[model samples]
Target: MNFFQNLALKYSHTMMQKALNNNLKVELLKEPQAKIAKEKSYMLYAHIPFCHTFCPYCSFHKYYYDENLAKNYFESLREELKIIKNKGFDFNAMYVGGGTTLIDEEELLKTLELCKKLFNIKEISCESDPNHIDPKKLSMFKGLIDRLSCGIQSFDDETLKKVARYHKFGSSEVLQEKISKALGILPIFSIDLIFNLPTQSKEQLLNDLRIAKKLSPQQITTYPLMKSNLTKDNIAKSLGVSFKDNEFEFYQIICEFFKDYTQNNAWSFSLEKNKLNDEYVSSHHEYLGVGSGAFSFLDGELLINAFNLNTYTTLIKEKQNANIAKAHFSQKERLKYVFLTEIFSGSIELTHFNHTLKCDLEKELFIELKALKICGAIYKEGDILRASKFGKYLFMVLMKDFYTGMDLVRAVFRDDARLKNKDFIDIMREDVDPLNAQNMEFKA
Candidate 1:
């Protein structure tokens, strides 16, 4: 990498980290949050936050799967959806993500049915794990889900075992068979792969790609190992290896390997047109997310729901809403976000940006654009600015840092949720203290 490029990326990391820390100093929301304009169309992202086993590297909010609690959670979610609809908001497209969204197949279908019935939904996307990818189960999702992205982070058996995926998802050979069976399940079938794991090697990465090529899904998303402090510490103890990134080399290999595949974004490769990747933020400028651990972005405000199951469920049931915290971003900050996302997607239309931001980009972002250009990160294509190869790599790093910051922010909110839980109305009774062992009558 050029010194200039490295310097620009470093600067961006620092700036973004600062912006994230500032923006995420959240103000706890009072009950019955204020309404906003319905001028924009939004993609709905519904989070299913229950996983059978937790992976050390993931930063998303998740809890262990509990069937009864999940049932109640879905019931609350449906009510929350109705409340949003009553607020005069509607969703165009929907994306279901999660601690394995397919854990309770029946409830999932029921929720999707309600969403479609309530809104004018054009398309729906869902995420699942390899263990849940059965033909019978997938058959039920065909009409409902346009895209199904399964998390298959690696195809190396030892790597899988290191991450504890081998026991849960399956061995690499079994995963290959499972993934092969998933082909043609939906309009777009995407499998996720993570590059540059703690102790992962170049040969292992190439091998994973080779297997991915053979499985031949409609879309494949290769992500760098994005680790937050929570995951970073856990990854060390769990994998017994440092949480490091070989981003530049691994990313180049991925981009080179997927030459025939269309670059849907910097990291997502697609075999077909009009298919969506898992990154909802890239496609939707503002999105409304429901369920525990969900985030909703409107204008410059970010609303976050409680991450705890009890808090989320109780809030939704009582208040008909689960929004627990909020943070505001300034216009400049919003523009910076747009710049990163648009450039990451390969190009930025100058006219669209100027009209939306109501500012002359050349005047406002002179230094940023100039720096990126001088660093060989972006090039001009008429009125549009496009990312050079190195720019894509920079974007990957930038986004990783951005999300890591979010995870750290979530850590704060999660703690806040625990504190705020005490003040909630009609609190669910518990025999044992979750935070303290004082209520544990079984304690010796």
Candidate 2:
């Protein structure tokens, strides 16, 4: 790395560590109505934390699927939606992510039914694994969901085996058949691929992209592996390989290979015109997250739901908010977040920053913005700030560090929740004591 790149990485790591360690404060809210009402526009995110098989490289909050438990969890999800509705919050779009969201077909249908009954949901996006891709499932989702994304991390059998997903998702040909069947049925069909795996080479990634392009999906998202403390250890132990820090070459290859397609974001490419991809990151400035292990951002505050499944259901049953942690951002921190998110979307409008934050962008983020420009990471075109070829990779590095820190925080909360503290305050006091009540404002 060059001197400037090294400096940028260091600054990014320090800021992310401080935000993770000191900014996030845990607390329980009896009623989160006032907080919910503050956001003018937002989407609803529902997380299903169960899967048929858990991959060792996975870091999000999830558990092995149980039929009875999943059924109960779906019912509790409905109740949680009712709670949000009662707070006078409605949503135009809903994004359901998970540990294989379509693990239980019946329960998923019922949950979508409840969503339709309760909210004026115009656009719905649901994520699934290859195991759930079939004509029957696609037919069921025809009208209920506008977009369906299948996680086909790689079509290479060896790569799948290394990740322990081969047996669960089957071979490349099997996935191709599934994708072929669902092509025309789903309105917006997208496939997710992972690049820069421990065993992945540029040739392998190029082959994966070729296969994906042949499938002719509406959109494709290529994600670099973001490893947390636990996942890093797990991947090394299972695959006997370590991940590399620099993926600039791999990212550049993708951007160049997919030049024919429209770049929707730093990582997503689309073949369809006027289609929305990367909804969670590019759709709304803020969103409300429901379900265990979900994160929500609103009015400069980040709210995280309890990671423990039982705790999440119990809190919902008792008519209390399931959010167990929150961090309120200072105006400067909020501006930084806005800028980062805009960069992820491929550009930032200087006008939007000025109007929204009511401050001059250069005046507020002088050092960071200037350094990025001087290092050729970003460039100005009229009123817009766009990520240069190098800047895109830099943004990815920043996001990876940010998410890795968050995963570590979730690990702490997961361990503490297993102790079964009577109140969230106890968890905050015992596990997150140093950061507690320092910059925290509780709604309890």
Candidate 3:
């Protein structure tokens, strides 16, 4: 659809409008509350699950506003913080995400202030809708936060609508205006851009890339649209939108464009170099989770909160330990996990793999990657692994393959361990159904 045709498509009225008028005031689930540990260093994540409008591709836990409920949530959050403080925890990274973090100007400021009260935060970041940030609001955030990640997915209007984005493209201009209005109160910031939006084209993407280069956010994270049955399928159909078959090709173009902008022709993308140097990388930081559906890494375990908001609130109120469920990864699994994470960041080092892991990527993984290297996929210089000019767009998929192979290797190790235990004969005993049991014993 290129950009224009997709932009002109109207949303069909067939889709059910989500029921909006619900009194979500007061805690929906009331359980005993926990005593917060104070003065301890730990990360904090507060999820605000309300959005003015929903985007089709979004898969976050969110809901519409009930003023009273919003108020209660904030109070509950403050109480939650008190509990954390009493527990003697301190956090260096604080990220408040979703449902539009900055809806009410005054309230948002108070929330920011409250965050400061809760943690000795060094790098605090929040996600904001374009509408949430104006001159006044951006100023409020100036000293309160170290970074901002704007959900400015695309500058192409048609593509924005196809994705059900609430604001228009060039909205970054408004963001820029707000930042300018703050008069030297700019927090290091980044913008999110999605490419290969249903039926989008190379030229349209390149045009959007040029605008991104001009805006010159400290960093840019480009992602491809991931469709799911849970979101706006009708709107997607209306636009005749679909994923590109040749995704890797689209990825190469994006990588080349950005690499050139950053290196060869730095003039166009030079505006935010200083900010990039000063601010901490947003997603690259080690994070901790709070609130519903948030995941945090602690003591080599991943703790995930209940996905249901009601369940989360109930657990919080009942003071039923927030440690509801946690998954512990072994040292080998952790190494594989780190490798996967490193790949997402566009690079990894050979030295990162310690001697204990049983993965041999020297031939199957790295050699194959080099031999059949997609134009912009990866580059190897000695031990350092980095993405090439065309690799950035395809990086996510490439990383997926690495994880897939790593999983196979992990599975092999498990099989080897089981074999060493000599459980093969004993395992057959457990599965011995009358007919199969006799056959199994005969085979053995």
Candidate 4:
């Protein structure tokens, strides 16, 4: 990226970050009316926030595993699901993300069975950690899950140790074997990777790509390391590595590796376009988000569930929804959001933009489009706008910044959700203290 391009990205990110802060001035909610036509096809997003262990780099809502607490959480999850069904709302697809979607086999299966019985869901996608992939578990998830996205941040043992995953999950070889066991069992199996770790080299990045290609899963999703305050600090101090954003260079390597794979989302590369990766936004425009810490974006309104587990369970039992805050974006902002989602998915057809959004895409998003063009991020073919090679990196930047902003949002509510530990600091301690090995010590 040149000086001008760098400046453009920084400025755009700054403005968007500012806008996010201003727009997410969430208000308290007693009842959230998240209703849609029964006939309309939409996606269902369920957030399961329990895991065996917590990664400091992960900013999404999550907690350590506890059986009794998990049982209660899943009960509330079922209540919320039933409430959505009672409201005459329907969905055609479901996506479950988490601390670890498969943390508790029984609870997860129960939830999936209920979801299948309640709605006309055609496919279900769930996230997993390498440790959870076993033959017994794979056999159980046969008909319950259509797609399983396993987090393989890096296949290098040294990198794995740096992130403290070596002890928690396993070495690269163990993880590879565990992940490989899922092939042919599920319809769509995806490898989730993160590039541009602060201390990762170009060769290290290439090695990750090569191994991922060798496995040849149905899909692969790669993200640039998002430098958020809490996560960056944890990774840097825990690993003794400097934090740098070498996104463009890292993305270039990924682009070269996945040149033939279809871009389902800016970060997602897949064998075919028919299968939906973990990103629910690309598959469905509007979705019903259920569970604590899940977000629902329907029409122009954003409904955020309570980040605190206790509060979420209470709210769901009483109101059948866990929403604690809400934000409604302006029409222009909504247009920009649609444009960003479309372009980030690798292409945007003007016809769908004009007809569905009922606005002049060129005029409404003129400023964003202009900056993207100047940065050589996007170009117009006939009526479609496709992201350029460099433009895809810009997409990564936008997504990283957007998610970093979300971390800040999580911080706002983190104070209330530290039920396991004394506070967030203590929670960070669990991840860092166990495997705070020096770079040389961690080197395999």
Candidate 5:
């Protein structure tokens, strides 16, 4: 059978099995109201789950490249897009993320052409390793996308080696030169920098940031070093290292520097428009993620594709004829998903919520958040809301609320009205601390 036929047969079989198990012909919940929808929608992400290599801290679903397998993957993805199109959904913003979307230039264009055909994208972006980008390939994206997010983890060669990033090298001067050439073709670019690496010093971080500032990309996102299970269980005998300077202290310094820098440059401001507004600050807001291990709050639902790429491919093949591995959300789950996405955009504007939603539970959460606002962990301007200087500075600390496990469990089992999910109960019972208040005072 051809790719489409094989895909259809697999999906049909799964639908049949589900129908039999439920003792009813399982029609998908296709009512217009039941459909996920979004307003002021911006950001679409496509996950290319084939990487040249993997980072230890990375838990993204991906595998090494294989020619025949990639063609199948593309076919499955095309089919998935058709299902969404048939449902009358479209997106405004677009982001294409790993496993490194810029693998082969020819294949990359084919994939991008498909995206243009599928989504009504206004502001499209793609992620790439520096090594993967060159003049001609970068030109392919001209007029097709507006932004480029590059993962230039470190300027320090030693740090890059320790993290296994395998990044491209040019002297800071040479690298910036090439980047400028690419920028002439692709505007609205940003760099990803990681701080607090194993045995890394604050001086090193400051130096890297100083160099990055010279390059003067519109934005620079710095994250503290974090260890996932891979690091914890790294039987490879990698050494463990703790913070040399207080991580929070380092974070505060970086935040202050960037805040002033962006303001002075007249780039753009985040959240509400302040007196110090700049185009650069205002534009860092929209993001979308897809693929196995990708998370997105598309429409009103918080959808997480399977974390296992193999499973994702299996399920997508099964989706050719009918739905495969269906999951749904509840009201509370919907709220949390909205909250998380807004939070990621660097703030939450209350004006976006319905007037009727201000009841007890929401009121309580707001009151708590407001206290943080007053103390300066977050900020509120009229109805618009955003992380305060301190909030953005110590984003890692505040991120706990979204991932307290309860939120995740709530998202996954949102469809069940009984609320008897074991995962939800377990997560809610965990001892994660509520948002800390000390961290709130003395804004960055």
Candidate 6:
């Protein structure tokens, strides 16, 4: 790495560590309250932690699919939503994410139905794998889902095989057929691609992008692989993978190839106007998360649910909120988060920040904002601070650092939850030592 690039990476890493540490001193709440009174606009995120098969590179919380267990989990999920509703928090948009949220079609449909009935849901987006998108499922989701994102990590057969996704999802031709069928029914069809795999070359990444372009989906999200302790070993053993520093080159290729398309964020691009995209971080300042291992940002606090499925269901059944840990943010910390998310979404609106926070950004973040401008990472345009082409990559470094920090926290909690002991809650309250924090081996 060059001097400036190394400097930016180091700075972002430090800031991310600080942010993670600040949020690590969590409190175990006996009865967590869903704070939704102050925010007039927010989205609901429901996490389904179940998948038919686990990929070696994934870090999300998920369990092996079980018919009876999934059915009961959905029932508990419904009750959790009711708890939020009873607190007078209404949601208009919902995003369902997971380890193949459509693993069990019946349970997923039931959950979606309840979400619609409970709230005035105007738009709903769901995620699935290539294997789950069939004629039967597409028919059921025609009008109910506004956007359907399929995880087609890569089209390269070798890369897919190395990641343990090839056999489970089928060949490229099968995936294409499924994509075509979904395009005929879904309002907004999107596909996700992961770049910079250990075995992935520049040619492979370009080919993947070419296939994505050929598919002509309304939206495409190309993600960098973010590995945690849980999957790093598995990935290395299964794929002989090593982290590479070629992410910037791959990102540039996408930007150049899709120059005509609108940039939704650092990773997402769209061809159609008013299409649904996964820029949830920029869209809402506060959101409530339902289901196990989901995180929530509300009233200047971050709340996390217990990662254990059994404990989650048991807590909800006992008429208690599933929240196990809470981290409150300071005003400055909140402003910094807004600033970072806004910049990542393409620009920072100074007026909006000033109006919302009732404080001048130049004053609150004088040094940091000034440094960003002086370093040519951002430039001022009227009341907005926009990211330069180079700024996008630098901000991406920050985002990758932040997300890795989050995954590290999840990894620690996931391991603790596996013990199925009451002391796990107390362990979660303690801050993660900086030296002990799991660092991302790759740029992701």
Best by lDDT: 1
Q: TM-scores of all models?
A: 0.91, 0.89, 0.66, 0.90, 0.69, 0.91
- Which regions in candidate 1 have their CA more than 4 angstroms from the true location? 242-245, 421-444
Give lDDT tens digits, candidate 5, residues 213-322.
87777656675555432233441234255535356567656766666554311112222222211122123233334455554444433344554445556766665322
Model 1: per-residue Cα lDDT over 385-404, one tens digit each: 99999998888788888887
TM-score of 2: 0.89
Error of 3 at 326 (Å): 3.1
Q: Model 2 off-target regions past 4 Å?
A: 1-3, 6-10, 25-34, 242-246, 357-359, 419-444
Worst 10 residues of 4 by lDDT: 435-444
| Candidate number that wins on lDDT, 3 or 6 | 6
* Model 3 misplacement above 4 A: 1-43, 164-184, 232-235, 260-286, 348-394, 398-444
Off by over 4 Å in 4: 30-39, 417-444
lDDT of 1 at 217: 92
Q: Report the CA-based lDDT of candidate 1 relative to the real structure.
A: 0.80
Q: What local distance difference test score does each model get?
A: 0.80, 0.78, 0.51, 0.78, 0.51, 0.78
Question: How many clashes show up per model?
Answer: 0, 0, 35, 0, 14, 0
lDDT of 4 by residue, 43-143 (tens): 89999998787676788788888899999999999999998888788888999999899988888999999999999998999999987778788789898
Each candidate's root-mean-square deviation in Å? 6.3, 3.6, 13.5, 7.0, 13.6, 3.9
Off by over 4 Å in 5: 1-43, 166-181, 233-239, 243-245, 263-290, 296-301, 306-311, 314-333, 343-346, 355-364, 400-444
Clashes of 3: 35
Candidate 6, residue 142: lDDT: 70
lDDT of 4 at 52: 80
